[model samples]
Target: MSKCPRCFVSLTSDHFAWTQASGTTTEADPVASAYHGGQVLSRKIVELRRPVDAHAGWAPPPQHAELELGGPVREVCPTCHYVLVDGWRNAQVTCIAMAGARATGKTVYIAVLIKQLQLLGESWGAVVEPFDSTTEATYRDHYETPLYEARGILEATPAAHTGNPYQREPLIFSLGHWNNVSQILVIRDVAGEDLENPENARAPWLQFFAHADGVLFMFDPLKVESVTNQLHDLVPTQERVGGDPRTVLRTVLGIIGLGTPNLAIILSKFDALQSLQSVEGSDWSRIMSNPGAAFSRDFSLRSAPYHDGDGQLLNQEVRSLLKKLDATPMVMSVDQPHTGRPLPNRYFAVSALGESPVGDRLHASGITPFRCLDPVRWVLATRSVWHWQ
Candidate 1:
């Protein structure tokens, strides 16, 4: 049995109970349940104990229960009640959740990121593909179509009942195998509006962030006044929008509490910064055009498989960049908080769109993602899957 990527619940056969009906016969079996009870557990606390009659070294799950299935039974996550199928656990799963204010380029990132990952996975002898039917349909209809095929900016995600909330489901991917073990990646994208409104998070559904392996907190560079002003001539500037990053970050921290997960504070829509190179005489131009700078170069082409040092170097560069953007206070909020506790965090920059939207159309340069894989790579690196080059 393996753990659910979202809530870290031990996903064993026993926790699941389901029912199936064939003709006039109805069968039931154990499927899954919500993560109830207040008892907190670590990876070792709930060990899989096998039945006495089972094979040697096999262990039975403690939360084992039976399901009275009215139809075909399926496995599911005990934490979020998300269902899963066989062979889902035979991998090093990494779960990431996205948080930001609305129009932070998350939907575009998802569509383009998938294509980029597919390109990168080829070099590692891995094929990146959607894990389930839901992901395939959703990714194609909602995310992939408008962005990739139609070449337009994705519309704002509708509210839940509005029927077009782009994030109604998690994006699950199978990244082939890594070092004899399969690598499964699950990403949960939340509406920026949801994260912006902390008062609404009292519900139990929002609690999953507390257990995520990593949370991508997108800080839209376009939201920064100075940057927007400087780039107004080079790119189209829309009305100042999005809730304060500080507010959203604090809410995310509050939801997760003290759980140890990588917090990636990302400077999103970085391609606009890249365009600042045209400013010619300005300091921003020099910084933006510096070929040797971490942000200027795409390290994804490096021959080393996974170099922690390379990623850390980029982190330092981005930290300074964020300071330049006047996000220092937000950094402090993550480091030395007024609450006296800080999350294990890192700073990153990614340009999912690679350029600002020209009205409803994407810039002709096409989507060139920068450091987009950094956050996900860091989380997986923590599991010791690809720690060293």
Candidate 2:
């Protein structure tokens, strides 16, 4: 069964609702109104009865005889009332939620990740495009223009309650049809401020994490004072830093509760750590200098599919690196989670900008992503959509 992009809730035959696009507008849908923070005009929401037999078919059950049928109708999630995309029920979706403290490079990672996904799709003779107009406009205005065209860092993603919280909408992309089904990718970026505070953990809007397919929780190395202190002399100091990662991780787990989404503990701003290879006599320098280490190179651009051997090596390397950065508590919690529902977890490191930004401006070297596709590929691979060659 496919899941709603906004709510991440499963859409079974028993749970289906829809609205017709007649020339009349009624009261706004409560869920849609809250999500978009505005009125969503449409006909009254009509709940469909579940089919009597399991083997009947996938189409919605016959509409009520009394309902007026004039124009096209759009299927919507019965729970959230958000309109489902055309042919969504027949499509396969991979829903991923982005979690991290402020300045962990979530916004920048997304901008670079989409471009890289397009390139990856080309390798498989497929096309990747935004699934909807909202995704395209949001990506272009909020994420792409500032970072790529203006050559500056993107403004922090606003919290859901803030005025103009564009992050509330999921960025949906169509990856063409694979395996006789339309493959879609849905990504939801959460503001760090929301995850850092305990109060927001219980907010109704934050419930999507409970059903997400994968949660990419980023841990910023730059947030660690020791790492920053070491790089003070070598690289320009980053002005913005997030709260304690341990606290943020705890908050994320609290929100997740018992959900079984795959957890990816990502180390963001890895370029800063990579720069430590030049710090003479330092243990980091020695560790990063190893020519054979998987973390030292990125082979994602190669024609071969994602290498499990390389990913496993990098996972071990990053797990140990997290320990070196004093993230032992976070690692221990993932192994023995407080929620008592252990999730399939992995360690990943990415450098979206390829180099540290000088203040608000990007590095002169331009954007060079490292291992940005690993997490998503891992999720898709499990479904047999994309696999290692």
Candidate 3:
């Protein structure tokens, strides 16, 4: 069975459910509201569970028990009540949850990642597109427009508890097909405010992190005082920043508990660090100046098999760079998770926008992403998807 595109929960055969696709009988649904972290007024939602006395292959009818209900009914996840996409069961899903503190450029990374993904797919005779209207509209209105059209930084993603948040749903995309199985990619963006406090770990909505295919844990280089001091002259003052990332990672890891998911520890806004290459006499300059280093340049010319040789090099290089930036604790947290269940992991460095925005506008040179695909490709490579083996 495939998983729910929104919540990342496996669509188990034990329970089946459907909700009225569209109905005038909207009411506050406490079950849906509880999973959403806010009130969710839903249509007539219905569910069924297997009876203990039923045979091994016993199954409920394709539709809800109340047959004469509505014009159309759609399947909904029994756990989170998110409407399932058509053919959700037959397709393979790659669900990734985005984790980061405030001002970590999570939105910006997503805005650019989609574009890069499209271009990469086009080169390899594949198509990547929004799976549903929700994805297309959300990407266009929330992610694509502000950055590509307006050429400005995206607003911080509002918390789920906020009124009518569009971010409550995952960004689902169809990645053509790999190995002849339709591949779906779902990205869940968690507001930094939601994950900032450890107490939020107890919230039911956070269960997705425990079940996601992978978690992209973004770490802002500028968060470190020493690094910020060095780049003071290069980039403008950051308007907003969040609490300690170490605390946020702990909260995320805590929520995951014993669940294991590939963890992509990303160094976000790496252009700030790349700028240090011009510092002439500093250690950062020398480190960033190594032309042969995997962090020095992008290998965008090739389609993967994920380039594991280079990936390994980049992993080691990023681990070393994190230590230099005084973020060893964050690395150790993932390496030796408090849950005592260490997830398969990798370290990555990416600059969604090639240069820091001189205030609200993107760099004058234009958006030249640096290895933004590393994390996503790493996840996809595991599935033997677009990166054909």
Candidate 4:
């Protein structure tokens, strides 16, 4: 069974529901309000009966006769009321939830990650495109435009309850059809402020984390006072910094509960740390300058499949780096999670912008993403979408 992109609930034919597109209005929908933050148009949900034995074939049950004479019916998620995209039920979706504290570069990473996915898809003989119009428009206006066209830092993602919260809708990308199955990638970006505040932890929308295929939890190394102090002279000061990452990580794990999502603890804004190479006589300088370090070079752009040897090397290297950055508690939490469930995890480092931003503007050198695709590739590889060849 496929899952709803928005709510991550399994989509089974037995509990199918839909609405007539013609009657959808601006009136509030109770189900949508619960998850979307407000009253959306009320979609008349038509729950269909489960089909009987074999030879009944693909036709809907007789009770829901309107479906047979469908004029403009739209299939929606039975739980969240989100309209399912065309062929969504048949597609293979890889759902990922983005987590991080404020200014951890989640938005920036998403912007760069999509572009990288497109390039990667080309190499794999696939054409990646938005699965729906909403995803297409949202990606262009909120993500692609601000970073690529305007050349400015994206504004912080608004919380789910905020009016006009663009992220309430998942960014669904279709990675063409592979092996007779349509491969889809669904990404949901969470607001850092919401995650930091314990008050928002019980929100219904957050339940998706428990069901997600993977979670990319980013932490900005520059947020550490020690790291910031070291880079004070080398890089421009950031306009906004987020809360302590440990606090946010705790909140994320709490939300996950017993769900077994593969966690990728990503070190964001790595370019800032990479610049430590310029600091003479410092251990960091020596570490950053090491040509053989997995974190020092990006092999993502290569045509070859993801290399487990390099990934394992980088994972261990980053685990050690996190320890040195005083993220021992965060590391400990993942290593021995309090959630009472086995959490499969990997450590990754990425520089979405490749260079630190100057004020709200991007670096004049342009966006040169480094290792941004590693986490996604890791998730895909685990799902058998790709492999280390």
**Cα RMSD of predicted structure 2:** 2.1
lDDT by residue for model 1 over 107-141, one digit each (tens)?
A: 77777778877877777667899988888998898
What digit string (tens of lDDT, one per residue) describes model 3 on residues 1-389? 37886668888879877888776888898878777777878887778899889898887865454584555888888988887866788898989999998789888899899999898888877799999998999999999999999988888888887865777888999889877889888998888988898999888888889899889999999898988888898887787888789989999998888877789999999999999888879998999989999998787536656787888899999999999988999889888877676899999999999888888787799899999998989988886767756
Which sections of candidate 2 miss by over 4 Å? 33-42, 51-59, 65-72
lDDT by residue (tens digit), candidate 4, 70-166: 6567788888888876678988888999999998999889989999989988897888898889989999999999999999889999877787789
Worst 10 residues of 2 by lDDT: 61-70
- lDDT: worst 10-residue window of model 3: 62-71
Query: TM-score of the candidate numbered 2?
Result: 0.94
Which stretches of model 1 miss by more than 4 angstroms?
A: 5-72, 301-303, 386-389
Ranking by lDDT: 3, 4, 2, 1
lDDT of 4 at 315: 97
Q: Which predicted model would earn the best lDDT?
A: 3
